[model samples]
Structure formats: structure tokens, C-alpha cells
Target: MIRRQREIDTPHISWPDKLAYSLPALSLAIIGIPVYVFLPKFYTDTIGLSMSTIGILLMAVRLFDAVTDPVIGYLSDRSAGRFGRRKPYIASGSVGLAISIIFLFKPPVLSGAMINIYFGFWLFALFFFWTLVAIPYESLGPEMTGDYHERTALFSMRDGFLIIGTLLAAGFPMLIDGIMNIMGKVATQRELFSFMAFIFAPLIVIFSFYCIYRIKEKYQQTGSDDLVKGFSAVLKNRPFLILISGYTISAVGSNLPATLILYYVEYVLKAQRAEGFLLIYFLTGIVFLPLWIVVSRKVGKKRAWIISMLINTGAFSGVFFLGPGDAMIYGVLVFFSGIGFGAGLALPSSIQADVIDYDQVLTGQRREGRYIGLWSIAKKLSAALGVGIGLVLLAKAGYQPNAEQPGSAVFMLRVLYALVPCICNILSIVIISFYPISEQAHAQIQREIGRL
Candidate 1:
């Protein structure tokens, strides 16, 4: 790895700087669960919006991100100031995100038309600032330290916190309502989210600022702002294309189970709920992250990643055959599948940073933001595809909510939830297996950049 003249010879990131970089991921992740899992229900049940209307608005807003994400990445790359390029966006966007959380979570009392208007406006604002903060914030990771193994450790810790934050957010509504009842007070969804707004808003701002104040951007950025040429070059980078494709495919696979877990448990496993399965899966991921990091160090990141994918997809594929009375079996399978979950999250991100380095080596430029933005698009696209396909297929199978599902619907549910993800994971593995940057290759890329 290259070192600046006045810089120390060490390539290791300090614990303080690593924590500063990783903690914001926790706060950012807190926003995801509430918005994705609870927000629609809140609007539909409490705020008087129809399910169809809420779905359209939510999907439209996400599609809107297709435009905003890359543009922000493009702008942030070109942005220059005393605080450096990414910091300006991170700091300012943090405030915007906080405000949007407040308004979006705590909607004002309104009638039919006014409610839709209020909902759409603030939802738009939230995602707008989310892209604003997320693109630049994620771009900072690759530049923090160029060491390959340390990069794994860094992202592992970051994603570990992300899972933790997600778990925390999952319980917020229930926790608040429970506490209210314990105190002999009634609670409403609006009031619950209002309390969450106060909690989450301050957290995002505090952590965003804390990270900005603590970490200094180390790698000197040298990149062009020409949108056409920059993106054209990004498209031409073969390794990046391969990595992003593989990641997107796997994300689509994983999203299936997340989208259909409830249906599968209720129908196939004859279960009342799936909160236990969800907990086992995510908790295992959080607890086992470091093991994958260690594995990556021993057997290179690429092989370790492929191994993790195999562990994940391989274990989960067995769920396709389980019938009613298989809850314990399902739990064991979920635990095995989750063993690779942390590696699945952290390794791709670490590999992405390396691919960006390869991009720099090719173009003599630092264009991490553009790559991050495109990667974000890949994720969004995968999610949209996953949800659309899973739900639509099941609906076609004659799904009726809260009723005994037809055999066709149950079959479709099992196929979509279990088999489809394995196939996607396998496809992802095939593509990612072809990625070119081994640890040695990335180190050489960094050395080449230093020569320039």
C-alpha cells in the first residue's frame, strides 16, 4: 500500500478511526426496517391510505432513486471544499435526513386528499436525503484503508452494527407500545412513530457529525467530473460490471426469503408467526461475522466469498422440501443458511472497494462515489425485482391473505422463497467466481496508483 511522505509507514487503521467510520452505518440502518417493514402498515391501518395507494407511492419513490443516486454520486465526486468532497455531502445530508425522518414519521392530521399529499411529499424528501447521505457516506469506506484484510474487518464491523440497528428498529413500535401499556397508557401508531422520529433523528445527526469530525479522508482523490466520460469509463470496467452483477443477483435471491418468510411459515410450516426464524437468521449473522473475516484472511476474500455463498445457498436450498411440523427443521436450516450471511454482506462490499481500486488503476482517477452509486442502483433494482416477482407469482397462484392458502399458492411460496434464492445465489457465484482482483492484485493496483 502507498503512503504519503509525512504519513507513517503503517497500513493498519486505528481502532478509533475504524469505529468512527463504522458507527454511522448503525444509525443509517435504523431507518431501513421501520420504513420497509412498518411504514406501509402504519399508513394503511392508521393514516387512512389504501394498500394500493401506499404501494404505488412507495414503489414510485424507490424508482425515483434510480435518477437521484448516480447524480449525487457524480456531484459528490466533483464537489470540493475545505472539509473535502464526501464530508460536505455527508454533514449536510445528515441534517436533511434527520428533518425528513421527523416529518415523514410524524405526519400531521389531515383528510383524504391532504393525507396522500403529505405522505408523498415527505416520503420523497426522506429518500432524497437518504441517497444524498448514503452515496457519499459509503464512498468513504474504500478510501479509509487500502489494506485488503483490514478492509474485510472494517466492513464486517460496519455491517454487524447495521444488523444490530435493524434489530433495534424492528422492536421500536412494539417496545414503545408495550412500555406505554405497562405504564397504563394507550398508544397509537402515529404516536409510536412520533416517538421514533425523535429517537432516530437525533441519532443519525449525531453519528453522522461524529464520523465527519473524527475521520480524515486519507487517499488523495484524483478524478474527472465529466459525467459522460466518468460513467462511460465505469461501464467499460469489466471487473466492476461482473462484481455488481453478481451482487445484484444474490441480493435478489436473499430478498425473496425476506419478502415471503411470513407466508412460508404460516402456510408451509403451519406456524402462527416467523419472528423466531427471523431472529435466528439475523442474530447468527451478527454473531458469526468475525469467523468469515478470519476465513477471508486465510483463504483469500474471493474464495472465502464463494465458500460463504455456497454455505448460504446450499443450506437454504433444503427448505424447499420441508412440510408442516418442520418448524424445528426450518430453524436449523435457517441457522445454517445464516452462517454465511455476514460474509455475504461484508465480503461483496470489501470486494467492491477493490474493484474501485482497479477502476482507479485503469483510469488514473478516484471515482468511488460513482461506483457506489451504481452499486446502490444494483441493490435497488434487485429489491424491486425480488418483491415484484415473489408477490406477483404468489398472487397469480391465488393467494388470499389470512385464509387457508391453496396448494398452488403454498407450492409457489416454497419455490419462490427457497429454491429461487438458491438458484440466484448459484448464479451469483458463477459470475463472481470470474472476478479478477485477488488481494495481491489489489495491492498491486494500489502500488500502481502510488507510482502516479
Candidate 2:
């Protein structure tokens, strides 16, 4: 039997401290969901870019962005400073994110050739800044606590708050639009951008800074000349590699539906009122968030994750069998799928913390930043692929946004929306089943590390 770590000696951390520390990282998700879900729609619809062009642009930029994550992760692992290596990057990245977000939505007054240039700049800046904030922020969770169950609880808090962020990102655009329509005020695209910036950007900045100030790092940096060795060590961790691969694939499965749901509702369901339907979808997930967390704790993360994947796969697969005018039927499917997504959202990070412990036991160094950076890269890559896949399918099906979609186009849209994600998620279930870490195994690993 593997001797467990002595629990008595571990310093007790308050729940408030954990919440404060985790909140800033959670805010990044708020910013991220919008960037992923809305930005493509914004460019394709509002900015007048062709779907193919937007897809190619997003794929190219995100590939570039994905490649940079490991390098940033490696550098962050070696960094030591007064505010800490992670915090400096977090602060700098937040500023960059704020500026990039503004520029992404608020382009120049010029149109035609100049507009593409503005768009290109916005794309590059947004991807770059998002990396800086996201990589370091994700690294914080595993480093915050060593207790296996405590780590799960910490992630539960982070993910619970993250659901709120997801809801806000998913819901706010519709809410704003509805509010404007109610007041009999017609807000232009530019005005909507300005309004979102005015309302949320400040919250992003304020909460991010407060999170930085509140969360204290337990791991003090060791000054070592063997930084290259540290990078090599992190790369050699096999468990991390497996987890990242599974995570990337699963992320793609999850994001594909989200990226295309609006299009599906509008084009296939023939519903112009997509926002309400989407709100219902997101609300179901939000309501089930706590339930999923509780379920994860009880059944163990891997099993919980697999269960969610199965639910999502089943829900998505059901879409292919539904025809037009089945909006309410589809809506019911979405609500069930959202429960699966809630589990998907909550458990993975907890499992990630478990992986971090496994790495620490073997490597004798905490390289959470590097691990998280790579994980973020995989997720971003998956998202980029999802958008690209959606675009390619749209093009193949001859989808025309402002015009009537052909029967072939509508049929193809349903297949991509339902069948593709269903297949991907089925595969994800297989991948997650291979995830070796469990709650008991993780606790044992932490115990071993404590002895060392």
C-alpha cells in the first residue's frame, strides 16, 4: 500500500482565500467564451467577411496562438519576481486583453481594403493577449492547493463562478439587444460594441486585479540555473501528454456545437429569435452546474466526465433525427445536453489538478504554468478547428447567411451541428475512459510527494 501524505502538517487555507484567488482566473473564461462563440459570428455577419475567409483567418491566427503557449508556459515556469512570475504575466496579460478586446470590437472608421487590415490587426492582438491571461491564470488552480479533495472543491468554486461568466458571455449580447429594443432605442453594431465595453470591460479589469491581490501562492520559487532541464522535465511527463491530448479532442467536441448553435437555430430551425433559445440552453447548463460538481465529487472525476460525454453525445445525436419545425423538441435536447456540458465544465480542471500532483511526485518541481499553458493551447487549437470545420461545412453546403439557405445547405447544417459533435463526443468518452488518475490515486500521489 502507498503511504498517504500526513494531513496534519499541511497548512489550512480558508475558503474565502481560495475564492478570491480563483475568481480572477474565472473572469478569463467570461472573456474567453464570448471571444470563441461570438467573434466568428460578429466577423462573418457584422464585419461582412466571407465565412471561408473568416474561418481561414481564425484557423491561421489560432494555430499561431496555439504554438506560442508552450514557450510562454516554459518561460513562466522559470520566472521569479516580487509579484511572482504568474502574477506579473497575469497583470500584463489582463491589460493586453482589455486593449485587444476594445480593438477587436471597435475597428477603425475606414472600410473596404483598410477594414481587412484593421480586422487582421484585431485578430492578431486578441489571440496574443488572450494567451498571456489564460495560460498563467489556469496554472494558478493546481498550485493553490495540494489536497486532492480540496483541489476538487477549489475547482468547483472556480467552475461555478466560471458558469456565471459563461452565462454572462453567452447571455449578455441578447440581454443588451433586448434591453435596447424595449426602450425603443435602436443601437447600431458599433454602439453595441461600445456599450459592452463600457459595461463589462471595467468589471474584467477590476475583478482580475482584485483576484491577483487576494490569492497568495504557497510555492516559493527556487533559483536554479537548470531552467532548460526544468522544461525538459515537464515535457517528459507522459501523463500530462495523455491528458492534454484527450482534453484537446474533447474540447473540440464541446466547442463545435457552441460555435454553430446560433447558425443552426437561425438557418435550420428558421427561428430568428435564436437568442431566447440559446438563453434556455445556457440556463439549463447554469442550473445544473452545482449538481455536476457534486456528482463529480461522489463518483470521481474521470467517471463523472465520461458520464457527461455520453449524455452530450446522445443529445447531439438526437438532432440528426429531428426535422424542421421541431424547434421545441430540439430545445429539450439542448437542455439535457447542457447538463452534460455542466459536468464537462466542472470536472476536467479537478482532474487537471490531479495530473499536476502526479507530475510533482515524479519531477520534484511544480511546473503548473507550463502544464496549463500547454492545456490552454490544446483547447484553443480545438476551438480553432471547430470554427474551421463549421466554416468548411457551411461552404460545402452552400450556406448563405443573409439569403435563403438551400435544402442541401439546411440538411448539411443539421448533420454538422448534430452528427459531427455526437461522433466527436463518443470518441471523447473513449479518450476520457483512458484517463488513469482517480480521486484515491491522486490523494495517494499527494501523500507520496509529502513524504519526499
Candidate 3:
């Protein structure tokens, strides 16, 4: 029987390796903004679908996509060939992703009702291919290194580029608009979106291909081949249960602030530069990310993550009281909140690798894909809940678009954007405090697995 590659004393992953592995995130993120932020408006305003119809379609497709995560994860875990389990899925999926992205962005001329059918079909395709690439891609991370602290650096690099890609994605529409202005022509929403999809289409494939070319998977197929049994194995992972519970709840809270930031800034703060403030928050996160890796090494991933959550929670707490003429203060708070942002993403992922190790000791198998699948489900579900729950409440509280919101609506916005997320983080901290693994525990886990 083949044994897994030695991860305990592995050398530091070179920068080149990290960069190559991280390239897909950059491409995926660039396209993600267009899909996430621009797609609904494009269909509603450009394609002539009503907001209600688009919302329903989006939610349905997303739910379907979430449900598919486990199946793909199980399939990826079961795949065995010379190309390896994750790469084949990623490589093949990027092709489908690229094609669907093109068609989705550049919808064909069609009859009125057919347009909606066309939209839903392509949206479903896009998400399916996205899951195919994303689940396997993320699954590879935990297996990349066994060194506890090094895992932080690894995921930090990945998430650092994720932040950078988000910033670039947010700015690209303006970049296109700027160039159009120089040409004495303004780009329409459709044109702007078409350019984005076109540029990122080949880019997604190129990045995935590059990653496949450079990085190698260290495969050990000791896991169960049966899907139901495989998932049953996952359900019993206590560390993962606690970690996912905490992360999902925190994500629900975190996502609330993200979905409502525009509403809060426009209605409650009555301030401008919402985009500028967002840029500051993400830029600060990317710039200070490496510092968190160091902090994780010094203090340990668990403690580092808790500290990051605390910083973010404290910074957001003051937002509920802010109103007009408080953009500067809000900016300061956003910046402080961002200081922990990279750590918030990177450290948990590193700690998640530890949890997977804990799982391996219990089941005597490596099932990164299933773990990541569950993580993805939590993330996507939380995102849907975050946006949907807050909007429903805001509507009930008397929110009206493009008008002065009522006092009750403003209060609800504050609670969702500020107080709710802070409470979630505090609860997350408490939950994560119960996680039993550490560097020493992980090392012992490796030893135990080796003996098996």
C-alpha cells in the first residue's frame, strides 16, 4: 500500500509555488464580482427581467448549487488517476466555467420569455462549474502542508490574493468606463459586463491550467469509497462540527454587514464614498495579511483567529450609533476592522486543516473535499440567509427604495449591520474556544495516522 507524503518535516513552500497555486483565486474573484454584483442588474435592467423574478431565480439556482457541493466533493475524493483527483476536476471544470461565463455574460437575442429561461439555464451552469472547480481547489489546501504554522502562511498567501482580486474586480468596471470615456464613448452596463466576462474567461482557464502545471497533489486514497459512509464519517468529526458551527454563525453575521453596507451607508450615515471606504477596508486587509501569519505563528492559529474576530467585532460595534457626518469615524473603524480581516479568512482555513487532521485520526482516511464541501454549504447558505433575512426584515420594518427610510427601518439596518454581526462574532469566539486541537495535538495526530 502507498503511504501519504511526509508532511511533518516538509520544507517551506517556495513563493513561486504559492503564487501559482493562488492564481485561480485571482481569476475566480475577478469574475465573481461581475456574476455577483453585476449579473442581477444586467438581467433586470438590460435583459428586461423584473427584480422579483431575478431574485427568485438566483435563490433557486444557488440552493441547487449548494446541494450539489457534497456530490462533487465525494466524486473528487473518489477520483483516482495519473492526473490526480483535484486537478482533473479543476482543469475540466474551468473549461465548462469559461464557456458558461461567456454565454451568461453575453446572453443571446431571444424572445421575451425565452430570455428568462436562457438566464436560469446558464446561471445554473455557471454555478455548477464553479462548484466543480472551487471544491477541489479548496480541498487541496489542507493537504499541501502538515506543519501547523506553515499552514497559516499557505492559506494567508491564498486569501491575500483573494483580497487583491476582490479589489481589482471592484475597480475593473470603472477601469472599463474610464477607457470608454477616453474613447469619447460610454460603456453600457451590458458592454461593461461583456468586457469583464471576456477578459476573465480565458483568464480562469489560464490560471487553473498554470496551477495544474506547477503544483502537485500528494495523494493517499485511504478514505472510504462510499459517499453515504464518507459523509457519515464527516458528521462524526467533533472538531469540524464545532468549527463549522462557529464559522457558519460568524459568516452569517459577517455577511449581514456586507449585504447591508450600501443600505446602511446611504440611509443611516447619509454619507458619500461608500466605495472609497470599501476599498480602504479591503486594501488594509491585504496589506496587513502577512502580519497575521506571523501572529499566528507566535500565538497559535486558534488564539490568533479569536483575536481577529474580537478586533472586527469591536470596530463594528460603534456603527450602530453613527449617523450623518460620520464617514471619517466610520472609515477609521472600517480600517481597524480590516486589520483583522486577512486573519479572519486565513487563520480559520489553517485551523481547518488541523481539524481535517483530527478527522483523519478518527476515520483513518483523507477526505479534504467532503470537509470543504460542508464548509462551502455553510458559506453559501449563510450568504443567502444574510442577504435574504436582512432584506425581509428591512421590508417588514418599512424600507422603501430611493427614499427616506423610516426610523424603524434605520434601527433595523443598524441592528443587522452592526449589532448582529458583533453578537455573532462574540458567540463564535465562545464556540471556537472549545476546539481541542493545537499544534501539539496535530503532531500527535500525524503520528497516530502514521502508525495506522
| Model 2: pairs clashing at backbone N, Cα or C within 3 Å | 5-447
List model 1 lDDT by residue over 1-452, tens digit each. Answer: 22232221137888888888888899999988888888999999888889998989988998899999999988887766567778989998999999999998988889889999999999999999999889999998888877889889989999999999988898777789899999999887778888989999999999999998988875444455588888999999999999998899999999999899988999999976598888999999999999999999999998998998899887888999999999999999999998999998999999998888787778766788899999999998988899999999999999999899999999999999999999998999999989999878877887887676
Looking at model 1, which ten-residue stretch has the lowest summed lDDT? 1-10
Q: Candidate 3, residue 138: CA error in Å?
A: 0.5
> For model 3, how does the per-residue alpha-carbon lDDT over 376-417 read when each residue is reduced to its tens digit?
999898998899899999999999999999999999999999
**Winner on lDDT (1 vs 2):** 1
Off by over 4 Å in 2: 1-13, 33-57, 111-119, 174-184, 222-232, 266-272, 397-411
Clashes of each: 0, 1, 0
Candidate number with greatest TM-score: 3
Rank by lDDT, highest first: 1, 3, 2
Residue 444 alpha-carbon offset, candidate 3, angstroms: 1.1
- Per-residue CA lDDT of model 2 for 309-420, tens digit only, reads 8888888888888766889988888888888766676577878877877877886666777777767777767877888888888888898868988988888888878888
